[model samples]
Target: MPKKRVQVVLNEDIRKLGNNGDLVEVAPGYARNYLIPQHKAVFATPGVLKQVERRRQAEQRRLEAQRQEAIAFKDSLETIHRFRIERQVGEGEAIFGTVTNQDVAEAIQEQTGREVDRRGISLPDEINKIGFYKAHVKLHSDITAEIEIQVAPS
Candidate 1:
């Protein structure tokens, strides 16, 4: 049997739970296909795991500390004021204009000093007329924000 140094993906939070020099049991197929290709994990030897335990502990602590920092920032982000976009209403009880994704992104950047890409802003539907609307900002996979825009007569 040929022993191979293989990288494996753990079910745990690999960022905090493992170190480069630590050996973890992973599926041979997974090690050969995924982890090695993505560079997300590394191969380690059995003897090295014991030595890298300390490094793993440090990484967990650091990951926790950084998580706390991110939480703090996220809380502050909730306080970010929403930018109100006012537009003119026209015939058929609709806005006399089309509000585009670029408009939404620019509004956020103008108000929050955050340069949000328009592609990340999701509108429920096309804004073809005058009305109050909600726009979505996908800040992260789990975190999102709704922005309110008011359309009025110009």
Candidate 2:
């Protein structure tokens, strides 16, 4: 006689098997003795599959909404186009300190009333002198906004 297999939905990740919420087939003995008793997985029933499908759909909807918001924000940033940062001049248009991502984020918020995460902004090079530079701001996985930054002495 052949050994019977059981279908189960994992409550947590199992090595070499599947991740949480994944449906997998395993030996009946393993499912009944170890997985069920240890609360690591449950039998994959019709109700369980339906619940998982619903949760997946909800998550997709939420992600789509966030992407839409990022698109709108990107449009707003494009309209603004440029932001200015004022710093103390030392000599020959060179500022006392280098411009940081936090400074650029603050400048954007001050000028446009929009909040941007500092970690997402990437500067081309060090900004030590008063001049025009470009920055790339990653708003979403697929969306990036380029804003011109003007550094002027205060």
Candidate 3:
């Protein structure tokens, strides 16, 4: 006689098996004695599969909506285009302090009335002099905006 296998839906990730919400086949003994008793998985039934499918669809829809919102924000930031920062100068055009991401974020907030995370802003190089520079702001994982930065002597 051969051992029987049963189908079950994983409640969470199981090593060398499958991830949460996945339907996988395992030994009947393991499913009945261990996985089911431990609340790690449930027998794969028609109703359970349907419920899991619904949850997956809902999650996909929510993520798509969030991505769309991020796209709109990126467009708005691009429209504004430029941000200016006034820094104290020492000699020539060299500024006394370096231009940091925090400064750029504040500039955006002051100009557009929108709060941006400083950690998401990337400066190309050191902005220690009065000049025009470019900055890349990551609004989302897939969306980025380029802004012109004008550094001037205060």
> Model-by-model lDDT, in order?
0.65, 0.92, 0.92
TM-score of each: 0.52, 0.86, 0.83
lDDT of 1 at 8: 53
Task: Kindly list the per-residue Cα lDDT of model 2 for residues 1-154, writing each as its tens digit.
Answer: 9878999999999999998888999999999999999999999999999987887799889999999999998888989998998999987888998999999999989887888999999997789899999999999999999999999989
lDDT of 3 by residue, 1-154 (tens): 9878999999999999999999999999999999999999999999999998998899989999988987888888889888899999888889987999999999999987888899999997778899999999988788889999999988
Candidate 3 lDDT score relative to the true structure: 0.92
Distance from true location, Cα of 127 in model 1, Å: 1.8
Candidate 1 lDDT by residue in tens digits, 1-154? 9655444534234664464454576666777787767775555655445556777789889977766654543454456634556777667867656888888778777776766667877886877777777777766545566667665566
Q: Which lDDT value does model 3 have at 93?
A: 84
Q: Residue 109's C-alpha lDDT in candidate 1?
A: 73
All models, RMSD in angstroms: 7.1, 2.1, 2.4
Candidate 2 minimal-lDDT segment of 10 residues: 51-60
Candidates 2 and 3, the one with greater TM-score: 2
